[model samples]
Target: MNRFLRTLCVLVMLAVVAPALAATDVEAVKQRVAKVDVLRGEFTQEKQVAGFKNPLRSQGRFVLAQDHGVIWTTLKPFPSEVVVTRDRILSRQSDGSSRVELDGRQQPAMRSVNAIMFALMSGDAQALSAQFTVKVEVLPGNGWKMQLTPRSAMLGKVFAQLTLSGDRYVREVQINEANQDVTRIQFAGMSDTPTTLSTDEGRRFE
Candidate 1:
């Protein structure tokens, strides 16, 4: 796999698993997520690998539509876009050339990745529990924190743990990999109102 896809796969996997949580708390988290139909935000991402002295940094904007899926556009450190839907994953370069594309029907893993990402973004805790052990904690103020550990040995070998913190929507994601690599992503300027998609953004999904 390419660097981008590999990184994305790991990140998406992180979104799907959690430790263990009380039934009520889990339900609460789900309710909070259910209120959001569309999510738009900007993100800063830092990635640290064993041999690098400095972490790689990237800035991006993302839109997650409940019906259309996700459109992630990275504008800094080189331009690229990744569109992930229930049936396909498409990657494009700054020049608008295709980098990679995967059909879920042809690839089971792709299908699972899509499902997991939707569940995570939507805060469908019950769906996540089917795949991972989940633990939830109330934060100091208004938010909640969640930790996810993979159930499959194969997945465990890829990620040590994934921690997510947020109130009504996901605010931060921290990923610890078994290979000693780490990634942290912080999100800001989020909104869910005006749930409709623009014409250009809608085209990406098709």
Candidate 2:
């Protein structure tokens, strides 16, 4: 299909799906999730690549400080850390040296990368609505599941869909890429106590 036709198709699909989305209280789910200002948890991610027989797996612990940023420490396969903040994404080696992977000072659009990660981890549905047509399903025991489909031709070329579900906090996220690859992440051992960051963890943000 031509580019024009593809664009038209997406517009038509949104026109049909918009009403049902409006009727759902997805904002409430966002509010519930946003209550946590600080949280720490362990995460396991599996990435299934196209044509690859085995999926790549990694285990990590994460600290989400709404005031600062997120710290993802990968402990297995390779020891490293990725810090996603409002200004840049910092990558650190196991030995403690780190570098800025994407700096918004050099490229303003790099901020979008920051926004996307914060919105996803912080459950800011309104932020995601800018790029995706989202559908929210309320689950038993106050849980909720959301599926996001790309809204633009550019994003549609990269992501087929993204599904996320959680109760008091986000529990899992599954991403479907346009190339038939899939990535799934699950969270466990979440806690909000001991709100203060450790000295070492605090230095990572510097």
Candidate 3:
């Protein structure tokens, strides 16, 4: 389930609201998402496997630094953290010990996944456009919706479709896997204040 949790898009703290969209397009949604330098927030995730009747659930918090990378710490059911950067991915336990590490330079798939993770967390429409066939819709209540289909061979292996729905800030991300599994991630008690990383966060980036 932890490996499947990698597909979750966590930490969407959009405190700065934008004007209602005059146009319903990826560009418009991109403009609405808060462009903060640092964002910290809590998240809840649900993983529904095809054969299982009950979904597996977990909640966690994440720190996203646009200039650096993202640190995701899962707190329930298990305690571990996955840190994502441009060049590599580092997964560790709550004890600050390494569990898994991958270099983008060594694995082609890792490079693609890293790019997509940053793109999704930061609401980078341009980056997403480059990789997925994107469709956008204007919800009746003023929220926006998006459907993304993988355009790459590597992505097609893990994901079938990705749905994003939110207003001002993305509120939920639903992942549809190729193997009939689904994962939904929602943020709670989210805020975009304190636009600076803490000392421990800074050290983790090293």
| Candidate achieving the largest lDDT | 1
Per-candidate clashes, comma-separated: 9, 0, 0
lDDT of 2 by residue, 1-206 (tens): 33332222222122112122323346666554535556788888787888999998888888767678777777888988777677766676877775536565775444654555455545554666777787878877878888888786766775698777787767877777777878787888988777888888788888
lDDT value, candidate 1, whole model: 0.69
Model 2 TM-score is 0.77
lDDT of 1 by residue, 1-206 (tens): 34455566764443222211222237666554435556677888888997889998989888777677777888999998877777888878856866788788987755765676666555565676666777878765567888888776645656788888877667788888877889998888887667789888788777
TM-score of each: 0.83, 0.77, 0.82
Best by TM-score: 1
Q: What is the descending lDDT order?
A: 1, 3, 2
Question: How are the candidates ranked when ordered by TM-score, highest leading?
Answer: 1, 3, 2
lDDT of 2 at 96: 77
